[model samples]
Target: MAAATAETPTDRMPILAAVCLAAVVLPLGFAGGAVATPAIGADLGGSPTAMGWITNAFMLTFGSSLMAAGALADQFGRKRLFMTGIAAFAALSLALSLAPTILVVDILRAGQGFAAAAALAGGTSALAQEFEGYARTRAFSLLGATFGVGLAFGPLLAGFLIASLGWRAIFLSGTIIGAIALLLAGKRMRESRDPHAVGLDWPGALAFTAMLTLFTYGVIEAPEVGWSHPIVAASLLGAAATLAVFIAVETRSARPMLDLTLFRYPLFIGVQVLPVATCYCYVVLLVLLPLRFIGVGGLSEIDAGLLLVALSAPMLVVPLIASQLVRWFSAGALSGAGLLLAAVGLFWLAHVDPAASGMAVILPMLLIGAGTGVPWGLMDGLSISVVPKERAGMATGIFSTTRVAGEGVALAIVNAILASLAEARLSTFVPQGGAEIRAAAQRLAMGDVHGAAAILPALPAAEIHNSYAVAFQHLSIVLVGITVVSALIVFALLRGDRASSPRAKSPDDTGFDSIKTGSAMS
Candidate 1:
């Protein structure tokens, strides 16, 4: 409901509070279901392959819907979109918690992602409009801090909730938190909209969404469904076609959803791609590592969650001092260096035996954390810097879309690699069989360790474990190679790029000087 007819001094604190509270959704969307996926499948009777959709659906919709939401927020009002998004997301979460089948959850979860797009775009744009100078810096810093806190402890919260309450409890919690945020915004937010805004670019939005959805679907489904399956091929072809149409649509539109001209700046491209690449690595590990601890290391959920403190806790502390580090080294150098360090951590992960102790995992985890953490302030500054002030909204949209979509794509790639490689290895272990062996192999590739064991003999189960390890190590090596290569490429591209964080006061310049003067979190 409309609360304030005009901006008032009282609106500032409530607006700030709403922005921070809304940040809770970020980590919940990113890391919440990871620790609870297996439990979700067990409770809901979904196949392992189908369960992958839970994350994919959310990611696809969230990424694809974000830019469009940003555009609409300008045309309508930020507060309106923000409150609507929070309300819809809360309702969806409650519905998700009560769903009797996986089909309903997947569909509703995707809806939640779309709802989240509105919240993210509106909440951030509202802050930029409402606050200025020193206060704006503090507000955004607090917002980023809340986001980091969510990422740092989300898994632990999931662990305890899954162990003590149930998988469904998290959804209920999401609903409650969202409702609280909605109340805060609805009571005090001063709605504002641009008078020069025109109608939305619906065709561009549709084409872009189709492109991402088709491509992600192809990748995620290819391993289980077979690489050359007609549907997979069709999906991939459809993705390409949709991408071409999207470009064509954007080229002609007066108000395009994406400004392809942004690609002109190599530095801008690097800044945008940096978050995508880093988030790709971070989300993959956050999901896969806990599964590794459970399936391979035989740790309980709580224990596995506790181990992630080494990986995530640094995200909280490092950002506070990261700007100082950036002063000594350029943001470009720090970003590349951080990625290389992450690659080293992955290399160490490849060496971990299934029977390795807690300390063995902890050390490499700590390395990964510091590696990922050092670039936060610089990244925040850099992403904002490369774009003009007039396009601040567009920059935020691009930054968020790439980051979310990258995580989704990375997940599909990881799952495909694991499933395909593991399946190949399993066939070698159990060479002579019909449907039973093939079915068991499918289960193994999906990391359903116990289910695969239940189907095969004890000796074959051990072989399946060994095969899983080898396949996982191979995937880790691939990740290392990708990270190392990306770091080198970026380093070369930014050869003379300075370490300074750009500040924005006028409409011509844009950067997170606030992040530099304040705390940083990516």
Candidate 2:
């Protein structure tokens, strides 16, 4: 068995570096969308709704391609697929920078998402192929840390680039990073391939993609078009039908894109669910925080961005302490506790009125940040630990797809809730006979604060300000309820026992040895 052979320090160096680079670049592509929203909207002459399609386009493609890309990684060589993905992503970024219209930019963004999915799926699978047992666990932790680093820094980088050179420069910077990483990867990385990998599951891929596309599109548009609209209703119904077909196909296929049998492992299933719920809660908070600080609190854009530094500070601090916590507590306990803390933090945030200072909100943000960090690190490690090495690519893909789906749902739900609340609230204020107030409230609800000043003629300044403050407070309560529900779901899925540790087997254990031998043979 390959497990019996000792790995020299040099043998691990190249793949480790490849993993690090892949981790940083892939997430940067996704995170860049969040900060570039305002600039993109302004330059492209699109409203907030159109700008949202920027993310929706990328996320839909990215999430949908995961399983297919993972299968490709297993069939072809990981290094080859990864380099191809990086090159494609870099080219797309360059194209996006040069795009003359919003539609072109969005198309490029979708292409970039496809490239990113390939890179992430291939590169992370390569990491699993190169390491095992405690080494694999540590490698996954470092991968999580790298992802956190990207999440923490991507916005700050985007903000700086936008401030200095405009939004075009942001895509240019991504192109440069992707080019550099591609060059480094080509120079140092070795190939990893499985001979036994079955032919491409085209029907499975198409069915799954159709299902995800319909579902994400329905969720994304439901807030604006109303759930009962023909398009929304069709999308929702199509998604259900497509998903059912996908499951039936997978069950019958000789080589399924997703081996549904994996779900039979309760521990593995529980571990995967942790990230889904955590990601949903985390994205919801991230989306809402900027609005709270800048839109309602009346801070400058720069100040609001700076305030986020408090929320991100823990990403740096928490990784150093995470391994220690894992040693002392089970992943389930740690994850559940983290979700609980985040819920509490969200509840605390709900009580924050417009008058609250940055200091008052900073603590809760920090707590939520720290709490979320634990599960973020544990999730990938736990999911992969229980799966066979040959299935690592598929497992990681599934876990990632689930996490992104959770994010999409979170964004959709929050947007729906906020839109509903804002409309309901606006109706009450509109009846009070202030046209200016009604328009300003409508703009705020639609996430169009830049156009807000144009609509503030029918009311005094004080009342307009008060209306926004009240709306944000109501939105915070919705976020609080979301976190609480998220916590409950996580707790229910996670088993309480420490004995369920995914990485419990030692390097010499048969379970570990078998996977390594099977992977090498394949």
Candidate 3:
């Protein structure tokens, strides 16, 4: 039977490689899934709501279960969960390729999200167990870089696959990566669990999952049914009530899955802001732009992928630059400044014509990427730094949960807002038609040109495109305001924050130390 294995210097690299490979699957699935959306929709011919769930289902499950997965990793065994997760992830990817209907694909994508949570939570926890002090910092630093690699290249690779093979090739690619990671880690990694861990926080877990589900469902359905629809209103209200319950459960639990006390620290609040800020400033664009470029703008999958490369490539180098810049500037200052720069990019992007050459928008994409990279570089280290050494796992779990849950929530909100705005614009364009025009507007917002055209046979394609462009520009301006506000809040919360020298030793020699960030990713 597999048991805890003694680690020497030789064992560390293989373990790191294994987990890093596992890390790549998350962003690759995320960015690649978005990039592949148009192809998937074109082939399957699903409604706008169904196609939206193609990405939403995955993110929703992945985000909601993360803290529970982390708790399970500590209660069971990290290696056991890691292997189970990776093996299932690969199998699901293969299944996805064979899925016959969009509904089946959406169901399988939900499974993929759950598997991703297990693999990431287990593998990351295992990594923390395997390394010490500076070595641990370096290992995580490299892991963050691996995520960047996946984000930077996932769209391009997915585009190539969809163009050369089919949309199914995207899932095939995931299977291959999962298989390799499984083989590498199966024999080398050690089993680990927290001896002090108690029973799983079932109430807290249930409450949290319900809250996210309700909130995401409300947001996704709002644009379709109208925000005031009874179903949407009920879902949003339920989410808020569930959230209150979750907080209460966590606060009272003997051993909560999410430790509520962490919020007492201003630095912790500041760290959480970084991810939410980027979620708006950067991550949401990964989905929206691909839809705009491929679906609305009529660019081929391959060309859209190339455009995404420009948006993501700066992540590769700007993070390293941010890491070094932190030597002179506080992380708070750098992060706030970065968000401000991203705001500038968003403002610039709002004015660019969709029909213009790709070169016209490349600079703004680069600026947004480069700006967000600063906080992305420092975020991992700061996540654990705010807590004591023994709580490292908890800190990591909270940070990751915040980052991913924020992504799912933010994506839902932005998508709803964009669709609503498009509907409003389309109303002015086609003043006479009512329900038909509204339906077409929703489809157009999602880049479903054929569907929109079918819904409103008389509408001009140029008008559909123009409506989406104006809505997108309005959304960008809203995002700019949100980002600028978040920057000021982050700056204030982290006013006195500073990173220790990379060589600085902790009391236990196992605490987090300063580190440089590397490449940017999705």
Candidate 4:
């Protein structure tokens, strides 16, 4: 038994390595759009709306499939499911690279999203099952660290690759990474199958997927089409109905895709909600900051990327300190503090103008980063801590789903708000349809400084600067409100005592102990 317990982690190393490699692909694939959007549009003859779909499609599928894949991982063998996912993803990456049309690319992007969901759901669960106590905590910490690193490096790598090779090279790189991950997984990964696990809940999976697809589609399109549009209304109604059906089915099914009963625990529910709000604020700010720098401040892509480093750097370092801080502060406390800081940062950002230095703009990002950093590990730990080991996959699935869904919703909201404000401001500033006004409007939309500069030859420089500043101020107010609301939610939902003790055994200890008892289990 002792030998078997000791060997479990060794057997798991290969799969973990494969997971890490597969994980990088997600951030890379998602971030590639930021750098390659202009190039992709030029090549495909698509507009910014098409570009939005490119990323939105990926996120929607990724977020929607998580719970379904988690349940699948629980039903199937983790290693087998994980490898299968990577294989599918690799094939789709190649397809995306070779796609003849933007529509085809969108379809392939959706496929990639599904594959990623499988990999993430199966890999995270397998890691939890394989490791014990301190090792498990360390493994999870490393996972968070890797995720942050991937996000930080993805855009930079995409910029370099897109500059050197065509945007196709981004997909090509994914193919290589996916292939390597598959090979390593096939060779080194060990199967983790649960003989007594329930059968696949196909009905539940389908319903959940449909619901998310409708909701995501509705949200994404709402910005272009009015929310009251018949299609948008129908989509929203369909989403609600599908979700209702999903719940009803889960309640009646022998084995549900998501065990709704788990949410009864306050801690479990709180942890999930906390991340949703935090993630919404985080992604919105991330999206807005880069646009602000490039559009109004007139920084280059490379320069904006570097300035953004100040925001991401804290994420890398804060988690390490967070591990220790969790010993002193409750997860709720830390999370609430983080949200407050983020809100304050956004409020400060609202005051920045076209004349503000890069350093000044970056200050708010730094504050937001530091505030957001403290809750990273604590939230994950809290979510899974309350779930039984058998349900770890499900818990992780829900956790991931909520986080990504929040991100999508947040981006949509921010985009709608900013678009409306910018349009209104633009109309006020440039009433006529002249070349100079058209040029200024376009520059403001792209966040390009050169276009703004060109307009100065015809229009007053101060007026151009004031218009941009006014638009940004409105954006800041919304962001600040989001942050503050998130903070309040955290305070209300999270318990003060939940993170007080480090010695508390998670709910899954019994299942984990049982697994430790059997030699074949590891």
Which digits, one per residue and each the tens of the lDDT, describe model 3 over residues 167-231?
99999889999999998889799988777778679999999999999999999988887888999
Residue 132, model 4: lDDT of 69
- Output the number of the TM-score-best candidate: 3
By lDDT rank, best first, the candidates go 3, 1, 2, 4
User: Taking the tens digit of each residue's C-alpha lDDT, what string does model 4 give over 240-263?
Assistant: 999999999999988787778766
In model 3, the Cα lDDT at residue 515 comes to 35
- What is residue 273's positional error in candidate 1, in angstroms? 1.5
What are the Cα lDDT values of the candidates? Answer: 0.73, 0.69, 0.82, 0.69
Candidate 4 pairs with clashing backbones: 295-447
Cα deviation at 325, candidate 4, in Å, is 1.7
Worst 10 residues of 4 by lDDT: 511-520
Task: Give the TM-score of each candidate.
Answer: 0.90, 0.88, 0.93, 0.85
Tens digits of per-residue lDDT, candidate 1, 369-393, equal 7777765545544554454433445
Candidate 3 stretches greater than 4 Å from native: 1-8, 496-522
Kindly report which residue stretches of model 1 are placed more than 4 angstroms away from their true locations once superposed: 1-13, 133-138, 355-357, 388-390, 432-442, 493-522
Candidate 1 vs candidate 3: the lDDT winner is 3
Off by over 4 Å in 4: 1-12, 291-298, 354-357, 427-469, 496-522
Distance from true position, residue 400, model 2, in Å?
A: 1.0
Clash pairs for candidate 1: 330-499
